[model samples]
Target: MSQATELEAPQAPRTRKQRQAAAIAEAASGHVGWMLLKIGLLAIVDAIALYAAFVLYTASEWVVLGVVVVVAILVNWIYFSRRHVPAKYLTPGVIFLILFQVFTLLYTGYIGFTNYGTGHNGSKDQAVASLMRSAQERVADSPTYGVTVVEKLGALGLLVTDPEDGDVWVGTDEQPLQKVQGAGMDGDRAVSVDGWTSLSFADVISRSDEVEKLSIPFSDDPNDGTIRTPDGRSGYRYVSTLEYDTAAGTMTDTKTGTVYRDTGVGAFTAENGEQLLPGWQITVGFDNFLRAVTDASIRGPLISVTIWTFVFALISVASTFFLGLLLALVFNNTRMRFRNGYRILLILPYAFPAFLSALVWAGMMNESFGFLNQVFFGGASIPWLTDPTLAKVSVLIVNLWLGFPYMFLVCMGALQGIPSDVNEAAEMDGANPWQIFRSIKLPLLLVTVAPLLISSFAFNFNNFNLIYMLTNGGPRFDDVSIPVGHTDILISMVYKVAFTGQTRDYGLASAFTILIFIVVAAISIISFRKTKALEELN
Candidate 1:
């Protein structure tokens, strides 16, 4: 009987729905911990990526990194979660990524197209914010003077000094100076009551707010004049008090009634046309680009530079490829002795410090004292750095030396990957060495190295370091309106505009930089597409 009872009581019946509901509840309970762990990992990755991107100073790079982090987290969650995740699981991340992409792309593209720059540069909102902040800081930090009372009557006069500095400030009772002092401090402490006719301590305390309104007088008179309060009552006036009108953009002294007005230029002025301030900033849109494009001062020799830039890039790519392929072919044979040693020697150019090597090459290329000119061209000066055409050629030659090792290394690996059967078949079919390479090796190598060649071209297009270190785009273009050089590339031209042009035309430089990006991106995209097509063929 006991055995039968135990067996019958072994289990309580449970419905399939109840078991399923219990499992769902358990899965739901684990979600908090699981979600937190996933989010933590994502945040760590994002922080690391953001820090690295910020260090590199890539504009809009943060936006890309953020999207990658969110996508990574959502994908992980979907794969790991036990409970059925709804489409809403990824909704937040997807919306954020889409918004980030759209905003950053539009912003970068717009900035690329606009003249936004420093000193009246940037978007309209940014400009206004910057201006307002500057104004606020200026107002906050302005110097204040202490008042020294000389006399008081129906009219009042006062002497003030910026005790922090030795500048004397004076004002009259009828009209005070525009400057004010002691914003929140004791008003009486800022003033010394020495000579008085009717004013009492109560009057001084009542006008505590007016302590900031006091100014130093700028009147040329030996005896100080008087100041009247706004209520037609008289009070001591500080000399430096000023009247400023935002509408008129003018500041006037109450005592001398001298007025200074903004010229709608960066400077302030008197009513007379005589310049009151020397430094003034003026906004001129697209003018810098126009000058760069059209002015004979820049244009005449710029024409020569434009041609040389193309020539330089072409020669660099051609020479590097030709020399690199030759080396790769020579070294591709496995039977060749000390192959690793030769590879190392060939790669040494890439391993060396670029700037240090560039300087050495510059010295060696010196026409009179240089190794090449002295050894071959004799002691005759060829002006390698000074002559425009010679400078361009010299730059290309230097770049070829610097750039070939990379291509050689890439080609070496690529050449080895080509199946022996292909080359053998080509040779068997009556192909010469040239034909074997042209048909079999070149085609296969291009499938791998074509993208690299395009990348190299893009890099050389903005090779500021090589250009800067070599000739500094020198032999100045004489006919240009502003100072420009013969060998200046678009990047160098932008640099000159931002730093060396008549005005630090940052807006114009920014606009030009955007144009340069468009050109580079277009070239890169075309090359990338070609590489992709080649890969498909392979």
Candidate 2:
């Protein structure tokens, strides 16, 4: 009776106005800080969105601006609206998945079908400007103009005084030399312009490299010669040896009278197999893929790399699993002493980063100064990382050291999880240890481990870090034009093709990546299907 009265005392009766006033006061007292925080965060987001909108508009990136505006509006609506309960959690994940995964994959696929390499990276206008600039040569009878080296916003420009009329001009790499007023002349040359700062003699000497390299277009027309200063004091008129016919879509060599036509293959080629570089990107569908098999220069090396990749992945998975399983079995005895200490010591290599471990092993495998040769082999010159066969052996050994600990962990857990009754029953039936393991425990272990082995194989197949850090795909193949070696796997080959050379073949690398993806996916699917057979052991 007392407890009931205590509970009922808090519900004391009151007037209608008093109840309404209490409800409003409770709400305000509890939520004021949280409301203020939400408001402040929203204000910050609005400010950032507005700033981004202004930048995108100024850059004339309309497609990107529209996307930003729509995303900002959606984000605001999702957070502010009371009806959007689940969208707040799912929106961020969906956006990141689309941007990082879907967009990257699609862009890479698009690149695989195009000639987007060294000389074919940018747009048509940039390529045109570059072609004209590269072929420019000094005209024999060109006029000499007085010029002053000037700077604006960290960019170098030329302040030119026309030799004939004495008109002052200023221009940078992106800007054509044009007439400007408000010139402050030192003697006969316009040293200082209105919007540019004239460099002192000391400054010109300090930035001699930049001053020598600076070439400003004389005007908008490509036919007109550029203004190039030789000693930062005198400018000369240089015209391009190649004349471009914009309307006719042709480039003619002024010296040889060879007409180069746009072959629609990203380059301008002449009739005799000559090509002018600085070409723009163009799509050449399936040519990159076909070159992998059909082209003589790439096919042999690619085939060898593909074979080595398979062999390396297969050997790495098998060796690591067997070694780890052996160690786990030896240490799984209940009566073993100091087994925990041994286990910790074994896992030490795994605790460090894989790339760091590979680097350490690379140093330790050096023939002349390595710990293995000096301390163990009595300074014998063993080419563990140089010879073709020894390099493969070294890679496998190092991979075994780095990979066995993870397998040991998984195999240990899987072995311990098996029921003791099954082994006891097998022993009671007069079965030997080997028979029991082969028939009973091993089958059960496979039920859990087969999927993991497939994943490990896939990982080792694309193990770029080990190859890159250790050998850098060295001991180059002498017979092939492609920059591949005996130690180079498919992924490493792709990396070298795309980045290491003077001509980075991004399209071919992307094609190789797609092929790798298809191979791995197919193998994984088939192996997963085979693993379904192992479930019967469960």
Candidate 3:
């Protein structure tokens, strides 16, 4: 055949098997059922994201709303598109990682740099409103209005009737009083309003605390008196004790004649160093961090807690690892009788949840009626958890009991991984058992287990449950302003600072959290580098 004719010749048809495979791939790619499922799931996710965006918008959290919009758009683009198959598998995990891990860390870091605590948690507008609401005084000779309490959508409201004009209005703590049409009235008292269910006299009595505190503004202007119900049946007019001058940005106490001016520290301060409560959150560069190290009220307990945290973590890791390694070595022997039973018994502590075990230990160590003092020591009254030095010892002992089995399992696996030939060669060279283990076995075992030890150290550094449950982080420190104790580690201290006391300082707690992360990261990096030397021994 001529070369040009040969080049133009028809190719052989595809084999039946190859054609079948191609058909299957095509069908799989365009399957209606699979496509429908993907569409349904993505639709649900988008719906949720849109709802979240709506909520954020209502709260004026524009930054979070923008992020949600971007993420939802990216999700739709990645899943619907045919390109980036690997990304299709990875997108869910990546999204979760960003939401739970990266976003949380970044938010915490931002809080650490800001005044985001009890008195400084909301916008300035909210703070001003709160100040005006909190500093209210009853207006003398104010005419009382007949009123009835009502509820709508789990929110409480007051329906008031003007005795003279017979005009009825509905109002809530958040919403001002507005005239309502078709209100059900009973002898000049508004019994109910349209679109709101009237609360019965009995129901109103049951929520007396809420009813007494409910204050609804008479008008949009802050200067107007609010309608408040002292007895849930009658409403009275009350005006704020502090008068706010909006243009001048100052609050003047009408009765005392003292003025509080904005000092740019998230609060209005008087000239006498008195600051108002419920101040707004604002960015304060390094103030929380500086307070931790400089403020005497915080610095003393913080320094002591930091030192104890390091010591507790170090001792817990060392004690647990040593005991675990020793037991692992003994049980690893082939001729040991009932070794399986012994191993199971050793792992019993780990099999039970650690927190439950901690509670059990706490009960056993109680000074008043504890097993240790009563049974073991014949009522000696030794304080296992109350005394400072004794409490530290007790924590270490309980942690070792709870933690050793894990390390034992790790060491047992690592021991099996070590080659028998290396030990035999040392034996042939006439080295003693100790020398052989030191030179050949230990170094090799460390190659596998050193990383785990470092992780365990980090875990025990923030071992909050043991400290919190066992001693409640106390023998008690009387001198510190915040709630702190002798046995308090950094994490437990952070917990006390953030949640336990009346004054919750979230900004300070977040700063402590960041410090903890830095400490753990630095230790892990350094230890991992040191473990490289053990890897070389392998």
Candidate 4:
């Protein structure tokens, strides 16, 4: 037998099952996926703990938790991505989502309760609360003036001015303003009674301390001299027995026998002329919410702004999508030239920070000397940031410039992944390009891009930077109380109220924030449902 004949007794070939078994054995030897589950669980626990800590302590817990989450996800992805890549990549992002949400919630809650306003920017809470107490106490000691005086140069030094003296005299607080010995004086030394039109130092000083404590009789007390004002009653006002019950939410003025009930709003007023100013740290349960809902000023402009916001967002998404998709499709053609250069140029807008870009655009659109006005509207200004309609439209224009580049990039990536075979098959059936796009391409494209569309809408809804930077919600609308602007979105309006309003009422602002959150959340939920419906349809 030759060497070749030695292999004549051939062994049975290894089956697919045996090959699979061998591969598994090799994988097990490498300890592949060994720590994947543990790492994932640990990341999840850490993210939860961080969020809880933030809820308890606010902004202080994010650093450690963020680092741990990033490290864990990175390590797990490095090791386990041989099995699952997407879950590992998404782990860190999920943690960020939790952190962002917690921060927003805490911020909204903090702004809702304090008088966070102007001239009171940092004095949002404790500092402003001190003002009311200080004001109340400052008027406690009204000076009772015994005398008034004027100084002279010669032997006759002082002159006394008195209410009792038909012959006026001048004296100091130390010396009573009574009849003085001086018969005549001249020029600067003369304390002339002609200039004194009953407006003496005694009159002004008497009113200095307006606050006083007076005793009131429970009934008709003729025995107590008809319950008159105390002895030194010249310019002082007595405090009637008006009791304020914060718990019961009522104010009772015992003298007037009038009761002022807390209307659950900020104001407390009786059927009578009695009223109370908004005291410090008052938590008017649902007044903030009610004001947002029913305030006539807010209602009128709010409806218009809300409508514009939706319209603006819709237009933004549509224009960006169509334009981006068109650009992406054009770029995807094999015959296209300088593709890399074109891509870089197209993505440049997205590369820059959005706020900076918005500001640049705002300046360029300025009515007085902007390059845009010089080109289009000539010498006169266009009122880009002034008129309500023009400002809204201008906002949309700026937003479109900033937002479309991102959409374009996304569409470019998505367009590359779509197989040519589907298009070819449709073309073979004599389908036109538009028909193929409408029937086959768009449906498939939407499956990938719908989420991005929802995100784009959501982003535009609260796109505070663009609105703030470009127009600052101007020009002012005089119709409203406290001066709100035309293009003011809910967030910008909240900023005005909580951060820049007359009183810096953080409590009111917080209340507005909560309302806005609810509105935004509801909108997001609706969008999500719409997404789900599309997914099901697909």
Question: How many pairs of residues collide in each model?
Answer: 32, 0, 0, 22
TM-score of 3: 0.87
* TM-score for each candidate, following the candidate numbering: 0.59, 0.84, 0.87, 0.57
Compared with the true structure, what per-residue lDDT tens digits does model 2 show for residues 36-75? Answer: 8877987887898899998899668899899889988998
List CA RMSD, all candidates.
12.6, 5.2, 4.9, 19.7
Question: Can you list the residue pairs that collide in candidate 3?
Answer: none
> Tens digit of lDDT per residue, candidate 1, span 16-123?
999999988886787688777877866775576556655445444666767656665665566456554674466557657777986666564554444444454433
- lDDT tens digits by residue: candidate 3, 25-97: 9968887899899999999999999999988996689998999999999989999887889999999999899
What residue runs in model 2 are displaced by over 4 Å at the alpha carbon?
1-61, 139-171, 175-208, 229-236
| Regions of model 1 farther than 4 Å from truth | 1-144, 147-245, 248-292, 298-303, 367-378, 530-537
Task: Compare the candidates by lDDT and give the number of the best one.
Answer: 3
lDDT of 4 by residue, 464-510 (tens): 88888888888877777544587777777777766665566566668
331 in model 4: Cα distance from truth in Å?
1.1
> Lowest lDDT 10-mer window, candidate 1?
129-138
Ranking by TM-score: 3, 2, 1, 4
lDDT value, residue 479 of candidate 3:
82
lDDT of each: 0.63, 0.89, 0.90, 0.61
State which candidate has the highest TM-score: 3
